[model samples]
Every structure is written in C-alpha cells, then in structure tokens.
Target: MATPPSLSPISPPSPPNTTTTAPPSSLPNNTAPPTPPVTNNSDPVADSPNGTFANLLPPPPPPRSVESLPPGTLAGLIVGVGLGALIVLIGAGIFVIFYRRRKKKLANNYSGAAPQGVDPQHWQQSVPQITVLPKPTPPPGITPHLYNSVEPPSTSTSLGSEKPSNASPSPVVAMGHSLGTFTYEDLAMATDNFTDSNLIGQGGFGYVHKGVLKDGKVVAIKQLKVGSGQGEREFQAEVDIISRVHHRHLVSLVGYCIVGVQRLLVYDFVPNDTLEFHLHGKDRPVMNWSTRMKIALGAAKGLAYLHEDCKPKIIHRDIKAANILLDESFEARLADFGLAKYSLDTDTHVSTRVMGTFGYMAPEYASSGKLTEKSDVFSFGVVLLEMITGYRPVDKIQRSLMIA
Candidate 1:
C-alpha cells in the first residue's frame, strides 16, 4: 500500500514560478537595489509579477552626468578654480620683482673700480671715492679760524704768526694739484671740535682724529702742532707730495685745511689700526703670521712704488712700523708722508737735517744727514726685524743696555 501511495504523487514537477529577494536591511545605505536585467525570454514569472514592485523603485535616476548639476554649483566651482590660479600667478610675479630690486640695490652700493695695477682679488675691499669740491675764493689777509672748541691763543701766540704766504680766508686753493678743501668750521663739526676723545693717534708730526663729513665719508684728520716751523714745512711737503701721488698701497689724500697757521691734512680712514698698534698695543692679540706676511709684502710694494714709479722718485724719510697703516683686510698703506722728500734726478743724495725715528734711522742718514732711497730701504729692514722678532725698535730693555 505504501508503494501505491508514492506512485500516485509522482506527477511532473511544476516549474518554480517565484524568486526570493534579499531584505532591505541586508544592503548598505549608499548602495541601490540591483535591478534584474531585462531578457528576451517571455516568461511572465521571471519578470516582476505586478507593476507595483517596479513603481516602488525610483525611475533609475535619469542616468547621472556632470551636466545634470545645478547652475549655481557649477558656477561656484569654476570661480573657485579661477581665483586659485590667479593667486598663484600673482605670488610668482611679486617674488620676481623683489629679487630684481635687491640685486639692483647691491650693485648701487658697490665702491669705485679697482685701482690700476692691483690684483682684483687682493683689492676686494673697496675704497670709497672722495668727492673733490670746487676750490673757493679767499678774502684778503684771511684770519685763521680754529676748528676745535679749544679757545684760540692771543693773536700774537696763535698759529697766525706762522701763516703761509699762500694762506687765505678760504681753505680751498686754486692749485690744480689741491684736493677737496674743507672749511675749518666744517672740519670742526666733523671731528666733534677735535675733542681728546676723538684722538686716534699721536706722533711727532701731530695728533690724528677721526672725522665724518656731512656726506657720510670717513677720514683721518692730522692737526700739526702750532709754532713748529719744521711741522709747517712738513705739512706743505705732505700736501704737495701726496696730492700728486695715487697708488693702491699708499694712504690716499682726501683733502687738506690750512687756517691761519693751523695745518690739517685729511686722509682716507684706515679702519684697522697702524702696524705698530697691532704688534705692540696693550690688550691686543698678537698678529698672526699670515697677516704679518701680508703687511710686509704690501709695505714693500708701496715703498717700491714711491722709489721707482713716482716722477723724480721719492724718499720716505720715516719707514717705521708706526707709519704703516692697515685697512679692513689688513692691506698695508704707507702713511705719514710728513718727512718724505723728492729726490732730484741730477743729485745722488739729498743732504737734509737729521730726521726719522732714532732706532729705524740708517747709519749714513744718522751720521751725515745723507738721505736717499737706500736710507728708506734700511729703515724698512729694521721694521722687518721688528715684525719677525716682535721687539720694539727702542724698548726699555734696549735703552738699559745702551745706557750701561
């Protein structure tokens, strides 16, 4: 009987008419329900049984595209991109302009062209140019004016007693060789009335003070002691010789001032102190070997220039260490031409009054006052000895020995 029942239920299996769909909870929030693809088979059951299921689904969102965005949204995006591009272009332009301006400013601050016959690399430190002003006319019988606050002595004792024949009310001279002539009042303002605080150096010639002109130029002003006929002659000689000479190793003569008997010479300021100061100054570090060599070479070149290159040649009567000044780069500049002499071509030697530092004086010059280029060379040799041994030419130890 069980077998007969099983046979009765063996009818053809009906085709599955319905498909099951996943619950809405099973899909991600951002994911759309996947649509069943349309097929060519005309099976009613395979498609949705009623149009209700298709209606519940959105009309497959009108195929999304960029053109479908709102007008306002598209315009905002275009404007934002354009503004970003413009800002970048403006920043680039500004940087270029600033770079060019900085480059031009540096070029403008550069000093004058390098001196002739000098190594450009060695002469990197630029020497500022001195602006030579026009010579001014002077009043007759010009009364000398003191540039400092110190009260002038009575007319009888003042430098007026030794006034030069060419002296005039105007400091400027008509001579072609004269440099820029400064008024006594102008120099007084520059040197702070030649106060003791402004003194930079002191020597047999006079006292040197630092001065700054109205135009922002720095200079060394040497004021010769009054009532010394020798000093007056030295002043005249220095002005005449230095005004005509120009070389890289020589101290440049910027200008000169002659008020009454007061004689002052203006020279380019050497920032670094004199060789003597560096070598023997209290509280100063000992100069390194390299710097000493540089100074020696530069001084030699300067001395050679004076003896060989100058017209009729020159004799630096005082070639002591104190007369060798240094610049920012420690370039030696031969200064203090007060004792310099012009050697005549026809004369073998110049017989002059004994002058020069005692220890640095040559034997011939000290004995017979016979000055020559060789005398300068001899003094230079003593300076070389000082540099090598770091010994003062006339120290207390040497003086004691001489006394004994």
Candidate 2:
C-alpha cells in the first residue's frame, strides 16, 4: 500500500499525457482488422486513382517480332504460292494436250484399216486405206464414191449411148488420193482458155494442152471431148487405176476437174514427147542402139510392174509406142490408162469386148477377147520387133510380113 511512485506506475499510462492508439494485435478478440487497398504494378492505368476508364479499355497486344523477319518476306511468300499454282496448271494443260493428240493419232491409224468381221466390199466403199486430206464442199449430184473399183466391161450396156448422169463422179481432190481439185475457170485460165495453140498432142481420151499452173508448174491438161460415152469411161478408168499405183516409169496424175459436162485431167508434163514421136516422126535422127535398148528395158519394167507388182494386176490393153511417154532423160513413163483392166488373182483371164490397136493385139486376145498377161507379153514382143526393125507396127507396105 505505501509503494513509491517511481517504482510502481499506473497500469495504462507509461507516462502522463501519452498517445492512446493500440497496435492491431492488441485489439480485443471480438473486433476484426480492417482490409488494406490493393495496388497493381503490371497495369499503370489500373493502379491509377481513376479505375473506371481502365476497366473500359482493352489490354495492350504483345510486342511484334518485326526485327526477326527478313526484308520482302511477305512478297516472296505470295509470289512463291502463285508460281506453284501456275506450274501445276501448266502441267495439267500439257497432259491434256498430249492425251488429245495421242488419241487422235491412234484414231487415224485405226481408220486406215479394215475392221474385223466387216465385209471388205463395204469397207472399201466406206473407208479407203489411203490417207485423205481436208476436202472442200463437193458439187451437186457428187457422191462420196471416189476410188470405187470400176465394173468389168462384161455388161451389155453400150458405151456410145451412156449419159453423164449414169456415170460415177470422177475423182475429186482429197477424196481417196492425194490430188488437187481445180475449178473449170482456174484450168481455163491456166491453159489460156484452152486454145488450139496450146495443144501439145491428142489421144483417144482427149486433147492435151501444155499449160502453166497457178503455182508456176508446167503441166499437161487433158480436156476430154464432151458428150462422148467412150471418153467418160476412159476418164473413170484412168482416174481409178492411176491414182493407186506409183512407179518411177508411170505417169503422175497432178489433178482433175469437173464442171457441168466438161471433164479435164492434169498430168505432169513429159518434156521429150512420146516414144512414137521419136520413132516415127517426119524428120528425126535415128535413135542409137543403147538408147533404144534402154527405153525397151524401162518399158518392160513398167509393164512388169503393172502385171506382177500391182495388187489386182493391171492389164494395159493398149501398151504401144504412142502410150509410152519419154521425159527429159528419155526415161519411159507409161501413160494412157484409159483402156486398163484389172485381173483378179483368182481369175485366169479377163474377158470383155475386143478393143486395142490392131497390130499390137495378141492373137488369143484378138480372136476370143480372152485377155491375160500373156497377151501383154505378145504385144510387148511385137513392140520389140518394131524397135529392132525400125518399122511401124502396121506398116502400109509390109502388111503380109508380120513379125509377131
């Protein structure tokens, strides 16, 4: 009770007039501590006093790696993509083009042959074996019957009374052979209106006129006489036979023409003239033995080709000196296929009307019209005799002394 003031102070006051604030832990157990305000370091706007504007704004994007990329990178990427697409398109286009071309080539190859199980005659009429070029529109009444095999002359129909309407259409350009087609006006212009001044020679079929073509080619244009049935038959036979066979010693057909009733044929111009002209002309030097033998051999080779080499062996019913044409080099070119006939491999001989030059006819052919390769051999022998003796086949004074 009687303690000193220095030793024992008041319990709540360390000294007189001190502060009364208490620490948080010294607070009563029933009272809770107050919460402190939060501060954001990452977002300065959110850390600011005005938090309403910070809530409305979107967060800033991450920093772009612009320095990591090379220059022109975007443009190069676009160009690379475009080039890749272009290369793919070009490759596809090339494939399509090659496919079409190969298909066309195969089709063309297949078209040139006869199909299995098909009739040969029907196939011949429909599709020929030769390659045909692009053809222009044909004239009226002209059918697609070019290269049709000629009917044998066994029919009793007279050649003198036949009309043009009854005859088959002559070979047009690009039909069954490689031949040019010309209009009547074009040929007339080429031959200077087909004047008699341009006439080079005449034959049983027509008159030949030497002319310059539009291409500056010198050709012999054969103008057949109109309204002659024999002429029409000759035209058909020549076109059918000559267009197929090809030999160095055979005349080449350049082209043909048909306008109204007019019929014309074009052939390569043989500059030297006919063998008949050289052998029997009015005033000409005699041909040497070597030259005559050479001509004879060449003519023989041509005849052999017609007889043995041709598919359906051709029999030149009129193989004579007048039909053998000579070129600049004296090479023989067998011309005038008007009277040619086809002898099948199965048949022994082709029998028909007796027609040919008188002296050159074989005895069997002249008597019974039984034409054969032997007949040609006989005629060839007669021609050889003429060559040896320098005498015409039917000499006026030597009628009784026949060599063949």
Q: Candidate 2: deviation at residue 144, Å? A: 23
Q: What tens-digit string does per-residue lDDT give for candidate 2 at 1-404?
A: 89776766548745456474555567777778755445445665645678766878898898887565565897898899999999999999999999999898667534443234333322221222333223434434545333322232222111112111334543332234445667766778888987999999986677999999988999999988866878777776766667656677888888777655666889999999988898989898999999899899989988988887665678899888888899988899899887888777777888878988888999889999999988888888888888888888788778656666
Task: Put down candidate 1 lDDT per residue, 105-212, tens digits, no spaces.
Answer: 556425422234434432232222333343333323555343311121111211113112323223333323436778777888899988999899997778999999
Best by lDDT: 1
Q: Which regions in candidate 1 have their CA more than 4 angstroms from the true location?
A: 1-174, 398-404
lDDT (Cα atoms) of all candidates against the true structure: 0.73, 0.72
The whole-model C-alpha lDDT of candidate 1 against the native structure comes to: 0.73
Alpha-carbon shift of residue 165 in model 1 (angstroms): 11
Quote each prediction's TM-score.
Answer: 0.58, 0.60
**How close is each model in CA RMSD to the real structure?**
21.8, 16.0
Q: List the residue pairs that clash in candidate 2.
A: none
